[model samples]
Structure formats: C-alpha cells, structure tokens
Target: MTIAHSLGFPRIGKQRELKKAVEAYWRGKLNQEQLLAEGQKLRQQHWQWQAEAGLDYVPVGDFAWYDQVLNLSCTLGVIPERFLADAKQIPSEVGLELYFKMARGDTNEQGEVAACEMTKWFDTNYHYIVPEFTENQSFAISSSQLLEEIKEAAQQGLKPKPVLLGPLSYLWLGKAKGSDFNKLSLLDELIRVYGELLVKIADLGVEWIQLDEPILTLDLDNEWRQGFETAYNRLQSTPVNILLATYFGALGDNLGTAINLPTEGLHIDLVRAPEQLTSVVDRLPAYKVLSVGVVNGRNVWRTDLQQWLERLQPVKQRIGDRLWVGPSCSLLHSPVDLNQEQQFADDVRQWLAFAVQKNKEIAVLAKALAGDNSTEITAAIEASMAAFKEKNNSGRIHDETIQARVQAIDANMSIRQKPYNQRVVLQRQQLKLPLLPTTTIGSFPQTTAIRAARKAFKAGKLTEAEYRAEMKQQIADAVHRQETLDLDVLVHGEAERNDMVEYFGEQLSGFLFSQHGWVQSYGSRCVKPPIILGDIKREQPMTVEWIRYAQTLTNKPLKGMLTGPVTMLCWSFPREDVSREVSCLQLALALRDEVQDLEKAGIHIIQIDEPAIREGLPLRKAEWQQYLDWAVRCFKIASCGVENTTQIHTHMCYSEFNDIIEAIAALDADVITIETSRSDMELLDAFENFEYPNEIGPGVYDIHSPNIPSQDWIKQLLKKAANKIDLERLWVNPDCGLKTRDWSETEQALANMVAVAKELREEYQAS
Candidate 1:
C-alpha cells in the first residue's frame, strides 16, 4: 500500500492563536500553564487535521513552542551551563523561564543580561537559537518532550513517525563557543544520547524514526562526511528503523555517501533534484524503502496532478510496497491552507496550494498509485491539470513588451556614475552630517491606534479623509519625536503603511493579497506575502506623498523608504511559471520608476531595504554566484538611476554576512545598517576583515525583544565596531526596525542610540 506522509505542519494556529498566546505570555498576561495548554491545543488540532486528511504517516515532535532546533536543544542536554540550575544537573526542574531565556535571553526588571547570538536558519527567513558549546560539554536525554509527544500521538490513534535533527547535522549546525576544537569532536557523545532516545521510542513500539540531515545539501569537507559515518555507526545498534531525510538541494557526490549509509530507508528531495531519482532507483538495496519527495514543499503553485502521477508511477513500480510519497521538505515553510484565502480571485486561487493543500496533493497521488480510479477524484485531478496549464501560459503572467524592456537592460542602467568616495563627499556637503550619524532603520512603532484607524478605514467605519488626517498626525508626531531624541536622518514612522513590502505590493499592478494567507517568518511573527499574479508595474508613485509629507516637517534629511526588488520577490509568493530572475527584473523596473519619482519629489535620501536578500541565498555554495549575480543586478536597477547626493541606504537583519561580504559591497549603497546586537559585534568581524568601503550602521542595540540597552553599553559596542573598520565609516542604529517593539522600548532604545553616537563623536574628537 502507498502511504502518504507529511514532513511537518504549521505551528501557528489558523487565526494565529499561538502568536497571540505567546505574546500574552511575554507581556505577563498569561502564565506558564496557560501558555503550555495553548501549545498542546495547537498540537492536537494539527495532528487531528493530518490524520483526518488521510495521511498514513503523521509527524510528531515537529511542533515547537519556539523553534524545532531549540526543542532539540532542550530534549538533548546540549544546553549551555548558565541556562541550567547546575552544570552537572541531569534535569533540574525544567520550566518555561529556562526555555525562554535561551531563546530571547534573560534580562532582569532593571535590564542587564545580554541575549545569546542568533542567526539565519540556512538562508530561510526563520531565526534559530545558536547552540553554544564548550570543552566541558556533557550529553544526556534531559527532557521528555519528544517521547511525550510521540506517546501523545499514539493516544490520538495516529501512526507517528518521530522527526529529529540527525546527530551529525545537529553538531554541524551548532557553534563551538570558547572551545579550541571542532564541535564535531563531541559528535560521539551526542550520538549516544540520540541512540538512547531512539531505543526508548522502539520500546514504545514505534517502527520508524525520521532523522533529517539537511546538512547533506551543503558543501561539506571530507572530515564532516567521515563524521557522518562515525555517527550513524553508533545509531546502527538502535532497534527502530532510521529514515534518513535530506532536502533543500541536490546531493550530487553526497548521493553516494548517503545511499551507502547504514540506514533502513532513504528520503531524497526529487522536486529540487529530480535527476537524482533515476540514479537512486538503479542502485538501491532491495530491502530499503525509498521515500520520494515528489510534491513541492517551499512554493505555492498547484502541482499538475497528471505530471505528478507520471513522475511517481515508475518509482512505485520499481519499489512496490517500499515506496512512500511525501512533500520535498517540511510544510512548515508553506502557509496552512489555500482555502482560507477567500478574498483572492478564483482564477489565481485555483492555481495555488498551501501546506494542507500540499498534503492533499500527496494523498491524491498516493491513491492514484493505489488504483482508486473514482470519477470524482479523476475529475478533481483533471481540474488541477487544467489550472496548471492556464497558469503556465496565462496572458496575465507575462507581457512581451516588458520582456523586451528587461532584455534590453544594459550595464550603464545598473550602476551609479560616481564611486563611493565621490558620492560620499557630495552627500556630506548636502546633508551636513556629523561623525557616526544616527538614524532609525525605516519604521517606528505602528501602535494599536494606528492599526485601529487603518482597520476602521478599510471597513468603512471611518472615511478616507479622516484616516489620512490621523496618518498625517502620526507622521508629524514621528518627526517631532526624532527631533526631540536629537537624531540625524528621519523616517515617516510608516504610519500609513501596513508592511514594508506589502504596502508597495498593494499599489503596484499584477498582484493579489489574501484575507488570511499568513505564513510564519519566525516565532509569533506572521506575514501575509502578496501573490504576484501578473507582470507588475507601478501604477503611480507609491510613497512620494508620504515621503514628501514627512520631509516638510523636518529640516533634517527624511529618508524615502522603499522595499528593494529582490526583497519583493524573496518575501512574496512569486509567479511560478516565470523565472525568478525575470520576476525580479520586472519588480526592479517598477521600483526603478518609484525611486526616480522619490528623487524628483525632493526626497533626497532613499533607503530601499533588502533584508530578505541574504535569506534568499541558495543553500549550496556552488549555486550562490548565480543567485547573487541576478540579485545584485535587480537591486542596482532599482537604485542606480539617482544622483550621487541622493544617498541609497539598505538594511539587512541578523544573517551571516561574512560569507557574502563581497556581494554586500557590490550593492554600493551610500550607507548600510545591519543587526549586530545579539551577535555582539561578532557580525562586525566580517566588515572589519573585509575592510568594507561603504558607510556602515552596525546596530548598537537589539530591537526585536523588549530589552532596552543602556547608553554605556551602546558606547562599548561602538568602540568594538571601531576595532574592525575606521570610525568615520560607522553609523549608529538599532538592529532592525522598531515595529514589533512598544513605544516605551522604542523611545528608550533610540534615545540611548543617539547619545552613544554623541559620546563616540566627542571621544573621537578629543583623541
């Protein structure tokens, strides 16, 4: 029998109930019991949904309060010593405080302790806690979260395949802090703990366990590959079968290393590397089951049912009962369901699928292979095939005139006439700025009042005139507050905008939005990325009025905030048939028109944010150049038309810039600000070592959390940043935007930020 399996499901509830509950806990409105209960409720709802959807293999232990990696950190005793009661404690009363501390970091009412470092999770928008290890690291199965979740699934009458990050990948993903050796040196200890956990699951009569080793997709050294051999050798003694799962990209040479492993089953992502399947089928051991990841997991386009059946039929015939159909990776990357997006046109909506819909795709394919040839199912399949055909060659998706314009793009269109040295002189003269000028990233807090007014306007309770008046007031207040805080550049606080990217999408042609099509960016943060339905163009100037209004209130340079082209593509659900590079070029042209409008409207300083740029990097090292080449090209198309004095500023969140510092320098912005507070200037080493040429604003304080940084602390961080780059090249700001934070923290953090800049200037002058 063909079994339909899901890698994982969305943790945030249908209405984002989890986000509300988590935020309430952070604000002291909910206790630990209430929060835990909410988490349990969400887990049950997700499991029941999968089971009812007729999925044969439902996943357990994939649900997390924060992140799956952190959950794994808790299950195994991979915790740093400070987070636990005792250094040698096996399990000393694990509570909510201990778990939350490791994620957001602990700070007293007076605010002191710093957050642990966090970075991008393998180029995704999601952020994961960096596992801090030391020489005295000890391993034990400290917690029962995974075991208990497995038991919970059994009680719910579902066949649970417990998913775990493989020991090799876990050790490989973590950082070795204050240690002189490789973190993989402790791989044996970690594997021992995993083996013990696996034995306990087998004791519960669980037949299969999924060990995800996504690190196989990355470029690995021989030692790392050998470490995999050493690690799985220990796991061979476990009673339960190990299903080694790998995704994100092609295995290439890693295919040989993976198939040769001593595991009962192997799962490879065919949606990304469909070419690998033929090679695997030819060389497979007859006894081992092969799980084929045929359905797309990371995108939104509807799978062509006919094509999927054709792709899977041959594999099912070769493997027979050993074949399992599944998504290419976890559905955690996809939205929950397309059914909730009722606001979209039927034409566009029919051509899409979310996580739940993806599971249905798996089920339909599995049943088709099982000889269930009912008319209803056959008609459904035919409809999906038709939708794919319509979407692929739809006139809405492409315009030949736009394609011609894109093809005609020249070298001169994507570059500034003056170099950074020359541009800076003109900018300094025009702006008359001080050393280490301070600015906010783009937005201020979009408080409850702002949301309420916008909601009222949308629902027709308030008139458009009234809403505009309220927004203008908010903008004036934002300008007044920045002046009182004594900052350099100013922002409009984005009072009229809902999101940085979504605001632009709403004004541009060829896009559709959803009423409830939200996907999780990270913990408790859900973003509804607009669906690109056709070729996009700016109908009119998107932000000129807001920028012009904000500038009229300030003598200081008010930045015209815009979301860059690559970010627009990376953050949104782009059209599937169109190549990503082509879609990005179209967006670049739209934003190019907007940029020129802003410059013409007397808004001299423009900050086009590409925070999603690094998150869009392909997982494999061999593939980075191709992505960066087009990504850089699109950004230049959006930015380069302006004069030198009209400074271009860009912002990136907490990501590993060290690997792509040259690409960052190539953007050639007048200034760049990045998140460095939690990483504690570790991110600045990339800048210092690269000798980054453009002006930099390495953030002085972390803004994601509510923790307010002290001016003294900010000064010390600036001094640390000065170590890597010349002081003249530095700017002062918070890590990211202040949108998630409240007014109190935003005000306090920015005040300290400006004061730090003043102190640094005085110190530099005196010296």
Candidate 2:
C-alpha cells in the first residue's frame, strides 16, 4: 500500500498559542518549565491531528520553538563563536535560552551580541535563521532536541518519521564567516556527524527518515553535485531508510544526480512542477519508493481532486505499491486551520484550504490511488471538484471593468516623466535636504496602546471618530520625536495602519480577509495575509488622509507610504485563476491611482516598499527574466505617475540583491533604502559593483535585534558605506520598519542614527 505523510506542519497553533507563550517567556511573564510545557502541548496536539487525518507516519523533529533551521544548527553544534560561552553553559544550566539568544541576540555581561543573519526561505514569506560557518568549522551532535521529540512522538503510539535537513543543503544554506572558503570542503566532517545522528535515530526503532535537500532545485556546480554523492554514500551505511526530499521547484539537471544517490526513496513536488513526473518515474529505481506530493502546501486554494487523480493515476500505474502521496512541501508555509476563519464568506471559505485541510486532501488521494473508492472518499473528491468549479466560474471573481483596465495599460504609463539626474536636482531644490539625510523606513513602533485602540475600534467598543483621534495623537508624537532629532525626512508613522498589505487590502475590491489566518515570518512574528479573490481595484485613495494629516503636523517633508504592487501581491494569497503578471498589473493600476492622490494631497516624498520583490524572483535563473520583466514593469506603473519634484523612494529588506542589481536599478526610484546593518554593510558591495545610479540609504542600525547600537557604532557603519557608494547619494536609515520594536529602543536608535549623520556631515565638510 502507498504511504501518506507530511514534510512538516505549522508550529504556530490555531489561535497562535505558541507565539503568545514564547513571547510571554521572553517578557518574563512565564518561566522555563511553563514555556516547555506549552511547546510540548502544541507538539502532541499537532501529531494527534496528523494521525487522525490518516497519515501513515507522524512527522517528528519538525516542531521548533523558533525555527527548524535554527534547531538543526543547535543539533549540529554550529553555534557561532560569539555565542560559544552561552553554549558551554547549556549542558548544565541554560536550556533553550541559548537557542533563543542565537535567534534574537542578547545583551549581557558579555556585551551586546548580534543574532545570526536571517533571510527568506526559498521564495516564500517565511524567514529562517541562516547558519553561520567558518573556515575551520567543526561538527558534533551537541543538542538532543530531535532525539527527545522522537521519543515523545513514539510514546503517543504513533509511527514517527524524523525529518532532517540534508547535509549538502544545510552547508549550502549557510555562509562562510571570517574569510572566504569553499563551504563544500567541510562536507566530509558534516557527513560524519550526520552518520552518527542517523544511527542514534535508527536505534529509536524509526523506520524512515525524511532528509530534505531542496538545493537540488537550484543550479549547482559539479563540486556541489559531487559532494551530494559523497555525503549520501557515507550515510547509506546507517541502519535506516533515507527518503531524500526536494521541493519549492523542479529538479531539472540535478535529476540524474538525485536519482543516482544511494537513498531508499525520493520525494518530488508535483504541484510546482508536475511536468517532471514522467521523467522522474522513468528514471527512478524500482526498489525505491516515489513519494508524489500531489497536494499544494504553499497556497490556500483547495486542490481539484479530479484533476490531480488524472495526473497521479498514470504514476501509480507505473510505480504500483512503491508510490507515496503527500503535500508538495512543508505545510509550515500555510496557515493552521481553515475552520477558524468564521468571518469569511461561505463561497470564499469553500474555495480555500489550510494546513489541516491539505492533510485530509493528501489522505483522500492516497485512498483513491489504493482503489478504496468508498462513498466518503467519493464525496470528498466531488466536494473538491465543486469548490474549484465554483471558484473558476464565479461572477464575483471576474470584473469586466477591472480586466479592461489591466488590458489597456501602455508603455507610457510605466516610464517616468524625466530621468533620475534631472529629477534629483528638482527634488533637492524643493526639499533642501542635508548631505547625510536621516529618516526612517516608515512606521514608528506599534505601541500596545495603539494596538489596543485598533482592536477596540474593530470590536466597535470605540467609535471611528475616537479611533481616528487616538491614531492622530500617535502620529503627532512620532512627528515630534523626529523633529527633535533633526532628521531630514519624516514619515506619518503609519499609526492608522494595521499591516502594510492588509491596510490597503481592506480598502480595495476583490479581496477577502481572515479572522485567524496567520503564518510565521520569523521568530514569534506572525502575519495574517489577505486573500486576493479576484480582479483588484481601488475604490478611493488608501493613504491620502492619514498622510495629509501627518503633513499638517510637521514642517519637514513627510513621505507618503504605500506597499508596492509586487509586495502587495507576493505577501498576500494572490489569485490563482489569473496569471501573476495580470494580478500585479491590476494592483499596480490601483496603486497608480493612490500615488497620484498622494501627490495631490501635497505629500512631496513617497516611499513604496517592495521588500517582497526579491522574494518573488523565480528559483531558476532561466526563468528570472520573465518574472523580473513584469515585476519591474508593475512597480514602474505604480510609481511613475508623479512629478520630478516629488521624490519616489523604495525600500527592500533581508534579501540578497547582488544577482538582481540591474533589475533593482530599472525601477528608477529617486532613492532606494535597503537592509544592510545585520550583514554589516555587505549588501553595499552589490550597489557599488553595479555602479547603481540614484540615491541610497544603507541602514546603519539593525532594528530586528533588541540590542541598541552606540552612536559611534552607527558612525563607523556609515563611514564604511561611504567607502563603497558616493557620499552625496547616500541616506541614513534603519534596516527595516520599527513596528515590531519597542518605543524606548526605537527612540534611542533613531537618536544615535541622527547623531551619526551629523558627525559624518561635519567630517565630510572638514575633509
């Protein structure tokens, strides 16, 4: 019989119980024992749910207090030298405290320490802690977290298949610290530790281990490809079966290497690249199990069971009992439960599936493939077919007017009226900004009082007028703080907005909101993304009133903040019925209207953030141009409809822009700000190498960490940035928004930032 299983499940509970519990521990509201209890409860509940959904094996070692990648780092004893002291004390004293320190940084007697750098996980919005490496990196089985979790799962009378991040992929996901060296050189040592780990896991009576190596989807050199063969060959001696899993994209050229590996089984994602099914089935060994991921894991849309059955039946016929069925990737990218969304329209609700629903979809497929076509299984297939049919043919999804507007877009709509050099001169003459102008990336800290007001307003406990007054007061305070610091550019603080994307989606047509749809972005940070159901259109100006009100409170040039078209689309659960280019264009047109309105409202500087643009790039380099072409065009369409005197700015955070520097320049914004402090000004190398035109703000402060930077520290970073880019074109700002930070740290950090700008300005004049 075919096996049914999952790559992973959402660690955040249905109502975000993990987030609350973890945050409470951070704030000293809960002790270590209490926090451990909460994590244990969430794990048991998730395992039980998967078992009830008819999974053949429950996934252990997939649960993490923070992130799975970070957990693996701990297990491998890959702690950076900065956190070595904390690690030494972990065996006897510290428990998961050292783990949280590696993730969130710490301020103690050892002085302030920055956390390991983080970046996007593949193309999804989920963020993972990037593993740090050194030239002489050593590996040892340091933590027993995975071993403990396996025993815990086995105690519950469920078959636990441990999921481990494959050795090659773990090294590939990491960066070489100190100096440049081939990370693959450490592969031999890494495999030794992995071999030791497999033996211990097998000793626990585990039958199968899911080893994920998603890097097979990427273009690899011969050295990296050979390293995979070498590593797996060494690990094949372990007395356990290894199911090599790859997802997020198709394994194109690496298919030969992957199939030849000495693993007992291989998992392929059929949702993203179903075209590879025939090729894989033809080449796969007869003795090896082929896990077919037929259910979509990265999306919310319900799968069409009839269509998938047609696709999977041919593969099942070829492979017979060796076939397995599951989700395309980890359900960690998806929300917890669809049943929690009680506020959604019935039609809209029927058209969606969260993590729990997707698992059931996997089970139903497994039964159908096994020829168990009971009435219940047949009804599930029928319901899935009906939901998809209704979604495709629904009148509410198609708007003739919006479609016509998207069709009518022309080349002229995407080009600026003048070039950057000419526009910069006009912007400078009008605004009269300083040399090293200091500003924020919009959004002051979202204080508890501010959240309370928004919650009260939503609950109808406070009237709209009362809520507006509360927000206006918060905006006023933000403006006063910036003016006192003598920062050159100002933002409205975004006090009235809940989320950058959700705020706009709430006011737009053809969008659906969820009451409990939340997914983790990083540590303890969760975002409830809006679902784009149909053609997008703006009914009225989204940010004009709040921005205009903010401009009235400050003499400085306040930036009109808007989330860019690509980010708005990428961050949300976009429409699957239409092409992404079409949906992005429709969103661009809607934002185009808002951009013009912000200009009319007398807001001179506008910042449209496209942080997710880099995240949205296709995994395959061959397919990048198609995505970049439309992505850049959509951004231009939204931002180009403005005067030369109106300075347009864009901000990107926690992304590697080296490969896409040309595309970044093509956006043609007057100024661009990016996250740099966490990488210690490493991202600036890309802009310098490309001789990127237009002004820039290389963030001098790492806002993600709680540790505050001294004024001197900020000055040194700015000086380092000056060495790469021209001084006149440089601006000063933080790595990203301060919404997640506390007001106390936000104020002190901005003060230090402004002080650095002043010290640098005087030094440049003296020189």
Give a tens-digit lDDT track for model 2, residues 216-303.
9999989999999999999999999999999988999999999999999999998889899999999999799999887888889998
lDDT (Cα, tens digit) per residue for candidate 1, span 654-687: 7887889999999999899999888788888887
lDDT for predicted candidate 1 compared with the true structure: 0.85
The candidate that wins on TM-score is 2
Q: What is the lDDT of residue 49 in candidate 2?
A: 94
Q: What is the lDDT of residue 336 in candidate 2?
A: 93
RMSD of 1: 1.6
lDDT of each: 0.85, 0.91
Pairs that collide in candidate 2 are none
lDDT of 2: 0.91
Off by over 4 Å in 1: 85-90, 109-111
Q: lDDT at 709 for candidate 1?
A: 85
Please name the candidate that would achieve the greatest lDDT relative to the true structure.
2
